[model samples]
Target: MLTRKQHELVCFINDRLAQTGVSPSFEEMKEALDLKSKSGVHRLISALEERQFIRRLPNRARALEVLRMPERPEKKAPSKVVSPQLRQLPAPANDVIEIPLHGRIAAGVPIEAFEGVSTLAVPAALLGQGDHYALEVAGDSMVEAGILDGDYALVKRQEVARDGEIVVALIDDAEATLKYFRREGAMVRLDPANRAYDPQRYLPAQVRIQGKLSGILRRYH
Candidate 1:
């Protein structure tokens, strides 16, 4: 059973979708339900989703579909029939946005490049704009930056990055390492976050910027 707010939210979303092809925004839902803040709406939506009454469409923030209606035990009147146009089936519940998972990349010394056919499903809200890929961090060289071992680094596909920006640096097109990209006169420098690790320097032609670090994701037990 859904809470009162959850029921109201689902009904509101369903009605909005039926009226228009789009779902209502959080602000609209909050206003409709007399919510104090958007966070409260988020919580109610989460509860409805967990109960399998609704699901979010892939790579969309406001794309919500009502899976099933809540039981209305208090209603004694006949149920209202929904028109065929407004009652279209929703996308599959397992729908998700997946980006390339390029296996593990080094956070310390450079490691040989690897290719894989793996992929990872990520929340669309975590990413924006251009293409992105995921890499499993293999070392603790960026500990001070809160990037730890076993963390998944979300990188935006880019051939260049500004100074002080953390990036995936490909060394001589043979190996890659995650570090801060810097230009020192005619040369390139890969700076590690930990003081224990020395900065790596190489000729500009020898180092290639593969991608820029967009965000980091970690799992806790």
Candidate 2:
């Protein structure tokens, strides 16, 4: 069986090659997987090669070849009747904005450099004019704010956010999390909507504002 890190690296390389027709560089892989150094990436590559999951070209740089791609789960057929709630979502008439759906954000640990696994389209009016991206919610911390697990949080890319607004906050440059932003004195507090979870506090310099939450989309099956 492949280790968790091995699986992540393989998927990252496969996804990058699929998107760009070129394999990702060691630096790109390192940044995507949040590894400390290129040596860590080399170790994962060696492990993947031993498993016959990937093959490294002997003479070329960044010429690693993917031998076996992982199988994706088959998508379910579309339903005949679309729900009214979904119909109400703003979609541009002539120009539908495509939002890249980055992978899930850790509500607890804070994931950084979200890999663009898919895309979601929303109306131009709803997201306004900005670089927008989507992330899958993973925890119940924001339940009171109506953001539940499995919901997509639409984020407008911005480096700063106002107090009391929902924003994607990167904590300590290691983990990215969704929370309410509030600056208290010299520290920043990330508050959860649910009462069960306590607000996380940190130094002002430790937190980096990624984007403000613009809207949310949910599906009922």
Candidate 3:
């Protein structure tokens, strides 16, 4: 059996090859896997080749091909037990929901914002029903939250959010940013997950809650 990292590396390379008809560059693989250097990528590639999952073309650059893909495991029956909290939540419908993928949102300093670059189709079960949208994260301020540069944040559109919930906070009606939201009387505090960033506080009137975070998606390639 492939190790977890090896499995991920093979899947990523396979995805890129299938989508773009070419292997991803060393730099691309390095970034996708969060590897420190291209050497790490090389090792993974060697392992994949030894396992007969992939092959490299001779005398060619970016010439990798997938020989076989791992078979997906069979789906098991649903469990009978459901938590009380989960039972209160509605089950998602059996249909794909298309959500608008808004342009990048700043995770560090607030930035000028735009919306509706494209739409992404996701299963409704993944995100609870609401006016949901997505934003491509652009900064590393939320790295400690497992959110990284280039990650996509799935958000549920709402004007209000509970304290400690990660939110898209628009400051002074001019800039949009993402952070954990906290309320202190009439003031609002936006806290970044990274210790490197100090929390930002502002008046409630100056900040608008655009959305509350629902989930995150990271594409390796």
Give residue 59's lDDT in candidate 3 (0 to 100): 98
Worst 10 contiguous positions by lDDT, candidate 2: 77-86
For 42-147, candidate 3 gives per-residue lDDT tens digits of 8778756755788999999989988887653223312221111112223444777888988999999898765547987766665776789988889988765557
- In angstroms, give how far residue 72 of model 1 lies from its true place: 44
Q: List the global CA lDDT of all models.
A: 0.75, 0.73, 0.75
Mind giving the per-residue lDDT tens digits that candidate 1 earns over 47-70?
Answer: 567557899999987899999996
lDDT of 2 at 36: 94
For each predicted model, how many residue pairs clash, with residues at least 3 apart or on different chains? Answer: 0, 3, 0
Misplaced by over 4 Å in model 1 are 1-95
C-alpha TM-score for every candidate: 0.57, 0.56, 0.57
For candidate 2, write residues 1-221 as lDDT tens digits.
Answer: 24345666888898888898888999999999899999878867865675578998888888878898554322331222111111132333455688899889755546664765898876565566778998988888775555678878888899998886778998778778998888899889998765567899999898999898877767777
Clashing pairs in 2: 110-175, 110-176, 111-176
